[model samples]
Target: LQELPVFAALDLGTNNCRLLVAVPTRHGQFRVIDAFSRIVRLGEGLTASGRLGQAAMDRAVEALKICGDKLRARNIRKARLIATEACRTAANGVEFLDRVEREAGLKLEIIDRQTEARLAVSGCGSLVERDTQGVVLFDIGGGSSEIALIDLTGHRSPRLANHIVSWTSLPVGVVSLAERFGGRTVTREIFAAMVEDVAVRLHAFDGRDRLSHVLASPKFHLLGTSGTVTTLAGVHLDLERYDRRRVDGLWMDRDSVDRMVEKLVGWDFQQRVANPCIGADRADLVLAGCAILEAIRAVWPSERLRVADRGLREGILSELMADDGAWRSRGRQ
Candidate 1:
């Protein structure tokens, strides 16, 4: 165990740049040894510009350089770095990647939406209980939302992603929605508009009703893996500061989610900033995220929501360890 090699995963998304370094723990799991996250807003103005702006690229590059340093300092046995929605949509996304490789000393591949949804489900697998009938797993990002319907009826696999029955990645996200609808001073009407926008988009997905057989099961629930859901969990707990230990895997019933969203809608921009769970970094964007969440609920109503603080980085680490047969010996025991 002492000689276990380290693995790293970096996810550069539309709103944040993050990295996770970990070592294999039990089967299908790992302990994070080091991590970093910063809100670079890589998709800033992307809705209108249709290209990766110089400023957004510079901010992302700077953060990537720091991540590069962390990777260099450790003996990374395997590493997978990925760019998400922002890079996928931007016209000069490839050009920006070239700059990152040259200047930041990191190579990031833009992963498709299906891969993104799969990794998100894989990362949050541990939170799903063995008795769970099914789950509507969703990750609301800055530039997009990836949702998957996991039907765990007949066969169960250690890899949660294997049970995925259907999935879809919506182009709408907090950043894009906020940019179009105004984030800081959103009124009830504006918030509704945002929700309706995403709802309309979601209505068009064929996967929305694919898991109908298990949708009404008493044990079925919604599992959210995103900053938006985490923030909601944090606020619901009334934490003085953001605490992943308290928020991760926490359960929030339907009414609880409603109360938090309503409370957020009532608060002004500065009030949103005042909450420790949602500092200035997310004050403007939180409502936009809520809009996305609201749309998901309307599509697949679930009374309970299980919040997962983990996502792509953890998923990548799990795959890397599994690929190398890191857990085979332990599993045999």
Candidate 2:
């Protein structure tokens, strides 16, 4: 607790390896000191091959090395690193993990699906309304989508009391979807097919009949935390530049989202690549995300969607601070 020790969080996923460093401030707030993200495409070819390619592994290791250096430079006192789906599904995941620990000097924990969804919820929990009835929270990553339905009245936490009523992880993600359907340029047919695929998987979640009852009520909110949602938000804002501060914590109605998706789909690959907020890096995969978002809209039919740029990393940091009593003390100050 002395001098507000800095905490570091590293998230290594199928598509990106990222690191974040932060110092908790008074009033239970924290300020980000540093962050690093590299799209390594670690899960490339995993869907068909059922393995993380050697080339992908090498890319991830290099990224982790850079993250290690950042953590060392900052001399982080408390740090936690985690690896997701691609690591857990790959045959050589353990081997790659060993290499990271020995070569990069970092131990990476492979968490289960439930933990992934829970952490995502924790990261965005601060945005949930305590009295807002049934709200759906989801994170669409490269390898999977984590969904959690919570009843607002169930919240017990000091800041928010939302309780998770039903949660599920869909196996579809941008990478997988792109690999399955197509990522480069999506046709209306391909787009509709992709959304249909996602809708089928969503059937496993808590009884839709029960969820619908809650959704029918007023102030029901849908919270989305992922590159997909954030990208859509950026497009909606029509920013010549992407600004997380402006996109995150913002609200977009169903009509706006639908219109934006239509505009994005109609744009040629070159036009999408030219957009400042999307750029070339995400141009190919944007359609895959649009498909997923459209599917969620069909299922839940919400009027508004809460966009969150925060997720796993924020969730992990919050959990660490809460366990260490740092978050609680910060509030008292």
- Candidate 1, backbone clash total: 0
* lDDT per residue (tens digit) for residues 170-236 in model 2: 8888988999997887888988899999988887666444566678776797899988899989989
lDDT of 2 at 219: 76
The lDDT of model 2 is 0.84
Pick out the ten consecutive residues of candidate 2 with the lowest summed lDDT. Answer: 153-162
Q: Which segments of candidate 2 are over 4 A away from where they belong?
A: 159-162, 207-210
Deviation from native of the Cα of residue 332 in model 1, angstroms: 6.3
State each candidate's clash count: 0, 3
